[model samples]
Target: MPEIPNEQKKAKMPKSVPFIIGNEAAERFSFYAIRAIMPTFLVAQFFNPAHNPALQSIAEARANELSHLFVFFAYFMPLVGGIVADWFFGKYKVILYVSILYAIGNLVLSLSTHDLSLFSTGLIVIAIAAGGIKSCVSANVGDQFDKSNLELMSKVYGWFYFSINSGSVLSTLLIPIIYKKYGPELAFGIPGILMCLATLIFWLGRHRYVKVPPTGVKKENFMRISLYALKKAFLYAWKKVFFNRQDKTVWETVAEKYSPEAIDGVQAVYRILAVFAFTPIFWALWDQNLSEWVLQATKLDLHIFGYEFLPEQIQTFNPLFLISLIPVFTYGLFPLIEKTGIKVTPLRKIGAGLFLTILSFIIIAFLQEKIDQGGRPTVWWQILAYFILAGAEVLVSITCLEYAYTQSPKSMKSTMTALYLLGISLGNIFTSLVNNSIANNGFFARYTGASYFWLFISILSGFFLLYLLVAKRLPEKSYVE
Candidate 1:
């Protein structure tokens, strides 16, 4: 390992830190630029002539469904990207190469705005590229620090997240302006420029990064272990639930061979799997902030200084709120808790975050009730929801990142990051399912719009809380960093 000079060690982070920061900043700008406007753009820019005209009742519904489908696949592609990065290209090279694809995806999106088929293809490509880069960049951040500087890693993550939000703030604020003033062309084109810049910035830091070579055995071992554990756990749980109940003799024999202590390790694996299961519900809510939520905002009364706001501008609140809250929670809230001798574990924070998510939707559901009661809701209601949701994000998202990195086998770090991303991907898929249910069912159907939508989320979140409580008692020491 390379030793840092004493003088340099005590100083602020090196040029590589800023380089990584800059890369992340630009990458986020690109992502949010397209994401902020995607829902609206789907309705306006990529309307299918066969499905009536854009914004017509039927067309609007179809467009929303299609937009969600795009979102689902965009998230799903990270699994493929993570696999490629872990098995073939190293994280650095994979990020660099996929970034180019990212840039191209944006360019294609810009050019294909009016052509539905081409536009959809462009969006798919962009999702693949985005998914590819998402894990790589995050894992790269972990690569920047090691055992000695690991204490500073939290601060580094804070800064990285800060850059992400700063870039998101800019993109959210500007992309809408560009769409309103210039058109979709400029709106999408600017992100391409930023993405190219991000790629260049990452490349510049190549030599400074902690370049861990791919361990050929690790990937194979992970697959074998994960599969074997999953299979055994399912069989054991099944036997306990069914066969053991009917035959006491069989139960005792099985218990003797695979005692509770023997199966504790399998339970731990199941617990981790359980975490992945319920986590997508949260993502369903998170990803929709840019899509369904923006659409809802358009229907609400929004004003600032007597000027009505654009829907896309409302998307800015998430990142803006994140940027402001990060320091407050990290510096102020964390220290206050520490001073009081209250230990804050990631799992506890995640549970609290999950509960907070329930509150966020409850707020939205309440606002929808007001709207349904013939009173137009205030935009401030949406703002409040964003504030609560942002808090949940800080608790769940940040903790998940740190937890995933720490809990992963050292050789499988990038794969773990990909797994975390997969949780979000699955969340989007859940969102799609929800969206599809709403669309296919009548607007007045039991599960349409806010009433049905929020009720479902509340149930899912409640289930997640229950699972967390049950899994909470499992020993986590095996995976702790």
Candidate 2:
């Protein structure tokens, strides 16, 4: 087969690219618009009527918990979503169906602005729709190319990243101002409209896309392979414990009908999951921008040069920083690191991100200490935290998508994406646990928020050091599809 020349790669982007990119930008905007103002909105909507001090305290804490839980469910739904797409619906149909739910969710939020119960119901629906398609959209972008035009994929994914950040930045900046000035109805309604637009754009590209049909429940499903791997692992361990040496032909003993490619894919899945295990903790730290950090900002002075910034608006910096830094790191910083003879593998990049996370928390610890001391610090302190944390996100989140797509077996690509997103869900669970523990024990973050952040710094630092030590030894496994 003749190689496609580099010049041709840029000259002809597939016809479907614009529709996908447009849908992503609109969908992201709709999601972020709601997310940006949720904490402030919750506190405003729920806490204002509480007359009793005890009820007020409960209201305040519940606000944070609800926000965290919403994000938790949003990330968690991808499991069911991914499964349906991989097994029955296919990515295109799943995305189309879910996008309608996404629009209705936004509509409910807007119409139910005054009633918290209705609003919460809308959020639940949105969580299902948004999270369901979350894994499919990027995976759909990957399905658009094969070896003939595969060279364009790298460039395609770069713009995909840009689309995510662009929508995020737009909504993060837009929604807060709209909420403050125009009221909740308009703030929520606009995103509802955008969700409809997202759906429309996705539908427009139906024929242009390179659609992947659902494989249904094959014999070599993830669960079976995982169980097989688990059994093999136990047998190997048993041999090591009793007989001294392990079985060398463990692979051969499995069902011979399973191709080498399938076995290799299963092994790769296990390895990929093991490497990605630490990411939930990473997201746990990152998701705080929407909850705890923003809550902290709400309590402090946000004034700068005769203007004040809302806590919700502070999230705008994440996408702004990402937009600027993703390219810089992609082109300038990563190349420089490679030039210095340091191997910058994906896992190592993730390890570096962990270290950067520690640094950001260290900054948070210091900032929280200032808040504890009754000295209202400038928003710059938290902005500094956002800056460093966004850098870590650039390193980790972008790399994870590439890692998940490339490392997965074709049959299990959506499954891999869901597993990747499940990390964020688990991270949200971790946050909920930490908060619940504090409620019970009254030791962690009871007196000073500084201590809570300091503890996170130590946790990440230990993990970062350990990951760097072990990452180099990870097997570079692959298969012929």
Candidate 3:
């Protein structure tokens, strides 16, 4: 292939790139718009007016917890959707179908604030759609480029992530304005419109996408083969090694199929499964930003430019911080580290990111302790937390996206991306579990809110450190350019 000039490469993006990015921009706008207002909306819509004054606080707490739980599940549904896409439909088909479902979810949400049951159901559908679409879209971007132009793939993903943050920032700002001024109906309705636009954007690029076919029976056969080998190995270990049976048939069969030479597939499975074990801790910390952290902010002194900020607006800083820092880290810090011969492998970056997460929580914990002691924490405290968290996100999330796409086998690319997302899903489930535990007033009752949060962060950081130690030994793989 002839070398394409830098200017031409800049001007001539892949055909499908615009549509995919456009879709993401609109979809994120819709999703974040709803998410930004959900907690406040739930409090206003679900808390019982007729309740006793004493129980109102409890009722509001329950409402907030339930709303965050809903958000958690919404974030998680991609795991199932991703599996389905890998096993059944191609990524394109899955995305198209799920985008419609996402639109319906928005519509359902827009239609009613009075019916809590219906609203919850709508949110569930949205989660399913979002999950289904999330894994496929990034993988699809990789599909657009082959070996000839693969080096540009990372740049494409960077742009993709940039678009996501950009959309999120806009929606974060607009959703609050809509919620505070126009009310829930308009606030919810606007997102629904944006979702529809996102669907249309996706459809417009149908022919441009380099669609990959589903794996179908080949994937099933591979799984079956792996399972059979594993079973034989276990049986042989029991009979020959332990029981000292005369039968060596199982041992022979296991060696023939699952010997060290043929274990890559099995090793991949084990490694992927192992990563999931610690994923939920990440999610638990992530969910706090929207639920607990925002709630905590309401109690702080947030007088900025003579305006008392809404709790939800605190989230805007996360994306703002991300946008500002991406350029600085990409051009400045990364180059300095490279020049100094400091290695910045994905695993190391993730470990560093995990450590940063601990710092973010420590900042939060300190602020909370001060607030508990009758001191008003500054808005800059929240800004600082967002700054640290955003840095961690850049290291972990962007690198993970690259890792998931490249490490996966050609046929299972979407599946690998889905597994990557499953971490977030498990994280959400973890949040739900924690929230439920706290609500029950059993084991966690001894700790105050800040202490409870600090404990969770400390535990997560420890788990993340362990994960990095183990993952460090695993050999890296990259099939994509």
Candidate 4:
């Protein structure tokens, strides 16, 4: 029994994809437009008092910490978002409602540009809205296609990602220039206006969408069953370890009450979640594009033939590479590889992605050595790393969305997507610990700062090996339809 039909396995993209694509471009523009200038704005505008130097130092460090905290909250909120959408409000209602919150949050940001308290409040509001809508919007995109259209789901997501980069490309590059030119109010205000338009674009297509209402499943049921299964599995394993393995019937009666299909679904959800746990490390590495990479480039050469480039401008190359390379990988390279009689299963691509990430960091490690030794490293090294990291993203990040949507039971699609986001939250937490360790001159920062880069490269390599072992032992059929 194949999960997808063979006849329609080849992609034939749908018509409604454009609406979602357009909406996503606008929404991402809103997101990145503000995010593009946020850290600098926090330090320069929000943290700067009438003209106090000591307060300025504190504000800069606080701004950095707050930025990471904002990201952590944004990812963590998906837990609430997924559950609420899955059990209470449907995806459509939640997306529409939370999008309003998103709009309001941006408006608050625009208004509070000079006021610290209100600006902080605005960011928290945006985090709430971002978390709430994160899982549902991607799930909503999946809902547009049916089982017959499953093959095209991957293709559609490719373009969905394409739209994301398209939006981010412009926002990341254009908005910061605005902030530098006009000031914070107009910079934030522009994104707010885009957010309002984003809401309208989504609203306009309300009638054309395929809405998946909540399955009417209670959160209690999932929690209660999860506890039951864990306790039982632990007890049964203990009985086998300390006692005889001959009497399986002792546990049989306890498991008999649940339907076999229900148990299978539960197990599937658990397995998918375990895989998601791998994602945060990937994101911890991926997110550096917006943070560490930009800061680090300021230490390098940005002048090309007398055309001065801002360190922030270095960030634009990510989206440029993303937009250019995604089509090559999705439409050209992957299909060509498939024709060579190789199976590029989702899990395998994930494993491949982790290794590519390791390679990217290894380059960073080498460059860090150059910087530490008072040698000037070329900006090209960072671009090479970006190219490798971008490839890793196509392999891991894009595939995760498609995998999370297709593998989960219809009732739990959003929930599974939220669980995937949990990895990113965890990854940020891990990243903070790493940063703190390096900052405090603690155990992880053994050599120069170069050790920090090597540490992540080593960690990701180990993770990839573990993935291969666990994947080889598991039944592949358990994951797909």
Taken over the whole model, the C-alpha lDDT of each candidate is 0.72, 0.81, 0.75, 0.76
Cα lDDT tens digits, model 4, 1-481, are 7587666577556666777888788888988776667766776675664547545434444454456666777899888888788778888888888989999999999999778898988988887788888877777888898766787788888788778878888888888778778888898999888888888888888888888888776633556667777777777778888885745443353456665555656666776777776888888777766766665675687776677666667778887877677789988988998999998788888889898888988888898789868787888898899888888888998888778877766655656767778778777767756655544556654533577577777787887888888876544333444
For model 2, how does the per-residue alpha-carbon lDDT over 1-481 read when each residue is reduced to its tens digit?
8997775655557899999999999999999899888877777786555545444334445566667777888899889887789789999999999999899999999999889899989988998899889878888898898776787899998899789888988898889899999999999999999999999999999989999899887787667866776687789789888988856656776646477767767777777887887788888878988877877787677886779888888878877877778879999999999999997888878887888888888887888888878788888888888889888998898888778767777765666777888899888877767765554555453623677677767777777777777787766554334
Which regions of candidate 4 are displaced past 4 Å?
A: 1-22, 43-64, 114-118, 142-160, 204-212, 219-222, 234-254, 304-306, 330-343, 372-376, 402-413, 436-449, 468-471, 478-481
Error of 2 at 446 (Å): 2.9
lDDT ranking from best candidate downward: 2, 4, 3, 1
Top-scoring candidate (lDDT): 2
Worst 10 residues of 2 by lDDT: 51-60
Q: Please list all clashing residue pairs in model 2, or write none if there are none.
A: none
* Global Cα RMSD, each model: 5.4, 4.0, 4.2, 5.7
Candidates in order, TM-scores: namely: 0.80, 0.86, 0.84, 0.80
Best model per TM-score: 2
lDDT of 3: 0.75
Which RMSD does model 4 reach against the true structure? 5.7
Weakest lDDT window of 10 consecutive positions for candidate 1? 51-60
Give the clashing pairs for model 1.
none
The per-candidate count of clashes, in order, stands at 0, 0, 1, 0
lDDT of 1 by residue, 403-473 (tens): 76555445445555566777787777766665555556654235545665576576767777676777567
Query: Could you tell me which residue pairs clash in candidate 3?
Result: 78-131
